[model samples]
Target: MSFIKNYIEQQTLNRRSLLLLSAYGLCGMTTAATLGSGVARAAAQNPKIAWSYRDRTNPYWNSIVSGGEAFVRSLGKSTSDLINLINEGSSEKSLSDIKSLLSRYGSEVALAADPNDMPNCRPVVEAVSRAGAYVSTIWNKTDDLHPWDFGDNYVSHMTWSDVGPSEQTARLLFDAMGGKGGVVHLGGIASNNPAIERLEGFKNALKAYPNIEFLAVQAADWDTQKANQVMSGFLTRYGDAIKGVHCASDTMAYGVIEALRAEGIEDMPIVSYDGNPQAVELVTKGKILATVFTNPHWAGGITAALAYYAATGFFKPSAEPKEHREFYGPTTLVTTKDAQVFKTKYIDTNPTYDWKDFWSLGKGQIKYRS
Candidate 1:
């Protein structure tokens, strides 16, 4: 029942690498540049491609924005052409900045944004469509909204199904604790899609390991400092009873780990999601039991590409099926043994992917409970 050991053994035989496919070779620069030229060239105006995210300080956001830049370069355009709308994790700012862009560019825009909150998606997409712009959104949206319902203007929505891999990490943590221990969790924004799903996964894992009691859980808001503060308090309350920790993201795990280290508790089993560079390094050192790699780079770039392609008339969003409109991106579980391989392939050397192969990196449609 030790999922981490099983994963490592499997990885040793399979040589399991990055979340996405192995690139045999890079696409010729010209070949990739010419991909949407026909449709793009036909338009009288160049649709401005823009990407919006929470902020750039976190290495995770930096990688996402980097992907946005790479996609612009593949189009033979300067990275400056990709306008950045940093919401700084504020929903109001997210709405304001997006509205400003819609007003400025009007119909000649292709935008990929994370609304920073699920409820914000509707208004954001509504404004873009009203301005006659093509828009793609990721990670935040209500279940009721559908790209097909809005014709081609609302291009696509992409979010990873975090439950499965998160559950695997939870099982790994519980099993490592010998199936009996008190575990506390540090989560992202409580209402956020991944946060909600990850917590659900942990709860599901508890159903299997009945003796592993969940001590307490708190929202860290995906902030390291907040996670540190919260974990410090958890230490005060639960202390050594907290035998394990589960974080919704690596950033939170970093904080939790530091808090534990400060208290001289180094041997607790912990797992996190989001295989950021630092988190992968921690995994290699056995500081983190396991983490999931969700490829924010591809998420940022493909979200932009989908909207850009739709705007250029390279594809009609209305013509695609619902599954094509909203889909789940790939998720890979990274543990100690395969951590170095993941580091080499995904972190150390940035592997090039065909951004045009958007769905190839995805898993399937985003399913939700009714």
Candidate 2:
């Protein structure tokens, strides 16, 4: 909370000092010159805020950026003040763009990022750390990576525990199929953490229902078009034998639906993750049996807030508890049963959040499998 107050005060001081100097006809005087330099040096303490992630074409990423913009607005700053570094799903581009910012802003940069993939997280965090910048990450990091390991520069990491939620959705799909049918999965990028865990959850559910047969699982790269193509191929191969579909994300589910529609197979049961508004609506319509809502809006704003506050020295990451440093974001299972309520509360009207209350929505510290 002090961080929010301090940020507002800093902005106020910057404006008030400039106006007072201009009124005194001291724009070119030594006093005004010093004030200007002070503002420039605010970077050394205050930092420039930024969010780096895959492109906003995906509804999930767009919601993430919306949250980031909301946090900027809360600070009495324009949304334009928050820099966006879009990687277009390329880890190379993700790291390069981050390094470019570090070269320009150095320790004055506070970055909240999704490293594009797990392997890219290390290099990205290393670049920021070497430049003495502050960073908070989500969704992609190797188990070996830790904020505490890098000291204060790596502020925190937040991610949803997708396994449980994905399994819950899968069980819903299996039950819809009467626990005995061929189910196929259209997954995200094979290497993505969510993709891996989501598929793992599907597999876990498969174990519980011995009568349900897994026809096939394919990587769709989390792209709607690609998922559509994959689903089409599955139809050609499995046809009426495929009774249910499990998608890694809602975006992919959209593609699967179109593929099914093309073949007049609209009645097939389906489930997915990342509860975009459209996906929630689909749930209400019985189009998608279930999906998981991860609250990317709050995740986006709070991740950036963590980095910004740490960069400005309002909070010390090193002193915070482990749960605050590495934690799971909130996750909600949305099904036909409560999709209407979810749509009204979370989809129709996004909730206002206290960005400074960083860990209120965190489920718990991230747990890794041995």
Candidate 3:
């Protein structure tokens, strides 16, 4: 009877030991799981990004999109990680698209945008700020709206001082025309700040040449088709009076050149902006006298990199110089004299700098001149 009791006691002890070991195993697993989960959360906390733009139809926007894609790729991410919302040329659509991206991505996303219009941009800026999403705007903001006004959420604002380049272009155009006769101006969206600056530059250049007359100033809304039609009408109205043409962008200049060809006016000089592939071709062929080369590819990529690095806590915007935060990108005038050199250096040359380097390029914050 005592032996039986001893056996039963031993069995009970063994069962208790097993239960204790099982509990310890479970506790260890729970601890390990908690640690693993924390690591995952940390990875997810890194900032993701999205960008919105006017449309993909234009080569300008394509360069911008490519830059964004390149920047994201530099982070060891796919372009799909950065949401691209194309507005299809509608301000309302752009505003709505931005809101949708903010709603979906929330604070995890940083946005870089060129809003469709000056006034339509405000609501988008406000919406992203309200959602605690970081934003940077390029080339389309009003003077009153500032990044500082909205706190850290509005990261930066970048715009080119188009006046200098435009004036240089105007001078080139006037010289091409032999400082005499009349020319027509193909301006951008009439209300655009860059458009206004460019026009001011053209007028400023005109001050130097007394014989040159501006036959007409028309708004083409930055569309090639509209520019073509406007040029056609101007040709009809002015005929031989038009000796030269000044276009806000190369795309518009293409239209102007087509009209000039239709009218058998190949000798007329033309100047344009945004030295795109077609523009570069025209410049090489001497069809375009001059054009301003604004590195849209660099601008687009750099803005994304800057915003991404800032959002990821790599650099603080507050510590950066005002110029770095919001200022002009580099611009160069490609006149017939230096067209070949410009093409070799900037146009034909493949970009050597990686997209990630863009963030460091804007290390200083931007300062506005009073």
The better candidate by lDDT, 1 or 3, is: 1
Cα-based TM-score, every candidate: 0.87, 0.88, 0.83
**Each candidate: RMSD:** 10.2, 10.7, 20.8
For 1-370, candidate 3 gives per-residue lDDT tens digits of 1322233235345445534532332232211111111111111256767677755556677677788887788778987676766665577877876666665556666788888778876888788777666788888887778776765667778777788899999999999889999988999887677788899899999999999998899998777667878999998999889999999987678777777777777778999998876677678878888888778878888777667765676666666656655676767777767777777876676475675454444424433448
What's the count of clashing pairs in each model shown?
0, 0, 14
- Candidate 1 per-residue lDDT, tens place, 255-298, comes to 78778878988888999998888889889999899999988888
Q: lDDT rank, highest first?
A: 2, 1, 3
Candidate 1 global Cα RMSD: 10.2
What candidate 3 gets wrong by more than 4 Å, as runs, is: 1-46, 354-370
Number of colliding residue pairs in model 1: 0
For model 1, what is the error of residue 346's alpha carbon versus the real structure, in angstroms, after optimal superposition? 1.1
What is each predicted model's overall lDDT from 0 to 1? 0.81, 0.85, 0.73
Q: TM-score winner between 1 and 3, please give it.
A: 1
Distance from true location, Cα of 143 in model 1, Å: 0.5
Instruction: Give the 10-residue window scoring lowest on summed lDDT in candidate 1.
Output: 18-27
